[model samples]
Target: MATNSTVSLSMKFDRTSILGSGGYGVVFRGEWNNKIVAVKRIEKTNCENNKGEDALQKLHHPNVVKLYHVDSDIDFRYYALELCQLSLNQLFNGDEAQKNYQEKMPPEKEVCLQLAKGLAYIHEKGFIYWDIKPQNVFISVHPTDVENVSMKWADFGLGSPLNDRGSFSTTEHNTRPDNWLAPEILQMKENFNRTTPLRQEGTVKSDVFSAGLIFGFYLLKGRHPYGSQFNIPANIVNNTPVNLKAIEEKKHPMHAIIMDMLKKNPNDRISAADVITRIANIQ
Candidate 1:
């Protein structure tokens, strides 16, 4: 029902309560026409190009947050999304609910299952989400019933749609994401020069690395991949052999397959299909 209004300047409401902040923009929960909406006001400098608007509009999936409309004028750029209400990250990582006090939270198995289904749909559409952190997963109540809620992915800033062959590579961002980046992305040799192709900077495998890290983060209770003893910065700089030897002390059922996906060798990593198959079989 929410469509972009080309002439309605009044719909641009000022809702300043901060939802989140990042390198590009600040998200806020605001109201327009008695409806609650979350607005992302990206800097005009970025909006001048307008891929953000096109990206949000192109997304067509139930598991992805829907774009209500966009309001961009000479003064500012506003991207209005259906407010998520809350995110899975805040529920698990915040307060004593799931972090401290040992407060019981939702079934981890169920959450993981939902995560896989959403991912399957995304991959089916030839899209790869570069960032898969918990902070990007949101929970929103059903429009008719506030008590019923659903999980959805948020943030499309760094995400990219796969090309016809389902591949894109990059090498510009060699700085390892430490616990999250896959080994090939962290170590694979690439030809870098002034005229080097852009795809070489990142790849489908890079996304796989990030995906493995999210599942690992889930199984590890939001701790760094390695605890305190290991030096991650050292591993990043030297391009030497690094292992989860630190977190190895703990045994998680998801460890084996996930680590396969995170393998330093891109060819050894599991595909997203394998991830879905594993998710389906997990008890």
Candidate 2:
């Protein structure tokens, strides 16, 4: 385990080998214990108020990105994680998006199953991954066969453990509205003001909805289920009807399963475990 402080602190990462950067933090391509890895560097201030490190240390699942080590200095905290070259979003919008899609890297069913398994594991461990989007789903591709890719959940900065009641509340943090955000979360954005601040309780079911949207996006070939780009957040917040006719019309095997996951009410959505079971039955 990465929890061993001595092993974690001894690891070294190249400052110039940045793989990605965003509001959350910067990820650097690095090596640990003779294996290639990604070193995620975040400010100590963030981790001080975050449970991501705690959650990552306890979660050990094949479907989740493996944390090899944890290192830190005066200003920042560094986490060495399994290196994944591509994200689910990259398959649809990267410069090589069209090429990747043509190659059909990792078939649709496999991707969905892998995602479900990862989320199921996270929930089983009593955590709510508030950030469940295509960008957070990392993919490791084979050098020869793109179809032989592996998917894993990565970036647990917004993740937190569920309370005794099976839910967690966020008073104010890094959460933001996005295309894949669940309706309940989007609704929070509506009431979020400078004075009132942002207070919301999130459950595993919210993750189920976001996961369903990701499946829909992949199956729909990058199209969002909630109308178009401009109105997506609003539509979700308003609980507007989802446009699933494309899958429904084609009678896609996962159509009904996804439909239930996207239900307006959180209680109506199926569990991540149920998703795995349903997918298994179809196969």
Candidate 3:
């Protein structure tokens, strides 16, 4: 019978190659106990005073990446995780094989359904997945069927637990990437007032906005809903509406649902549960 394995300095694995790198740390493909796995190496300084490790340890959904083990030395922390074949970003913009595979991508409804299920589980567990871009969504082959693939949410480093009011502060990370930010968050930054409570800067709706952007990008073939303007961030900050006419003409069935998720007013945006229901209906 096959069983899960763990790794450590004493039980070391060979780092075959680097999978990717970002502000957080580097991910590498590794071989452990004769099985391939992903090894994430994060500097101790980068992970200090953060709840990411705790968050990943507690998360156990099929639609979320599985953490096999964690080990650390004086300088760095390492996470042994299930190896995913590709990220949604890679499928859209990676090498020739990855690009070619996009043509065979799952339907948008199915993709969103998986994402919404993951988000629902996260929200139910009292964490807000602040990051929901394509790069954070991974594609993996089914354990029993080599021909089947599924999407799993990855990279929970930026996730935060909901506060007393079911919201989280975005003040500490002021320079977050603007492309995926919700309008309210941008507005809060623009109209910064010391008297205003920092916790009000973000809510569950902010995540919905980011997820909507991912769906729109997928439907539009990697283009931002606002098109390729140099001032895209500024436009997003100002709550410039995304024109959905093109997607509607393309007969993308989720156009209405995407627009609902992208509402300028956080109060107007649809909840992750609602998104799941809507997508399930379509499917």
Candidate 4:
């Protein structure tokens, strides 16, 4: 198990150190044992269904964020985690790092493989990372090799366990960005309003869809496979075809795997593990 030093040590944080904030909590940059760390302060009420802390405690992987400690007070729960340099969203879209990311873009196969490995590990542990967007994907630069950077999956607040039927159901429609969500999720939300029976439940494959889009966005240099921001949700729901011509022209090996992952039907999508397998020979 990872160390839990929060109880024995006194750590301080404030709003000024916030790195990001979401519906669940705000993450602050702080120091622990002379090492920089991220402290997530989430209100207790908002964490009733959050599986992030518990899941992080059990999941230790190169591609998964490390949890250093957990602490709680009368009103909020605090999590001490490894501090990453920047999020995928910041690296890809932020003004400060845009030029840097473009100049030193990590090899496509390596990044895709690492991300798929993380998702596969989560699935192997019987959990689904319901949110797999650029914001939740973090990047860390190598201490010795600047050219060698690593990526990891973070923020598991929206995650859930896969039941005996290999799926889970939720009524929360506003938990994720519609453009980044799986088609089945959007369909369920639409059906719920009409009191129609759900045809498909959330599953690991749904996560695959989101992950596929992220990988495509990264490989395509910020172009979404599903068209523009306003059109993504509709395109996904309508099963609109994706245009990967830029990558296809370059003969990118992961192109086919990404296509399989973005299939509208959850059943048609490839498993995270299979994604790793398909890319194993890339290098």
TM-score of each: 0.73, 0.90, 0.88, 0.89
RMSD of 3: 4.3
Residue-pair clashes, model 1: 10
Write one digit per residue (lDDT tens) for candidate 1, span 68-133.
Answer: 777766655777787875666676567664343223334555555566666666666666666566
- Top model by lDDT, which number? 2
Our model 1 lands, by Cα RMSD against the true structure, at 5.3
Candidate 2's C-alpha runs over 4 A off are 1-8, 97-104, 142-147, 194-196, 241-243
Sort by TM-score, best first: what order? Answer: 2, 4, 3, 1
Give the per-residue lDDT digits (tens) of candidate 4, residues 1-283: 1333443445555557778998788898876667678888888887776577767888889999988877777777888788888888887677766437655557778888889999999999998888778889998777678887788999747667788899976654355677888998888677564344444468999999999988988887777878887888888899874657677788888888888998988898999999999989775
- Arrange candidates by lDDT, descending: 2, 4, 3, 1
For all candidates in order, the CA lDDT equals: 0.60, 0.80, 0.77, 0.80
Residue 251 in model 3: lDDT = 78
**Deviation from native of the Cα of residue 216 in model 3, angstroms:** 0.8
- Give the Å error, residue 26, model 3: 0.4
* lDDT at 135, model 2: 81
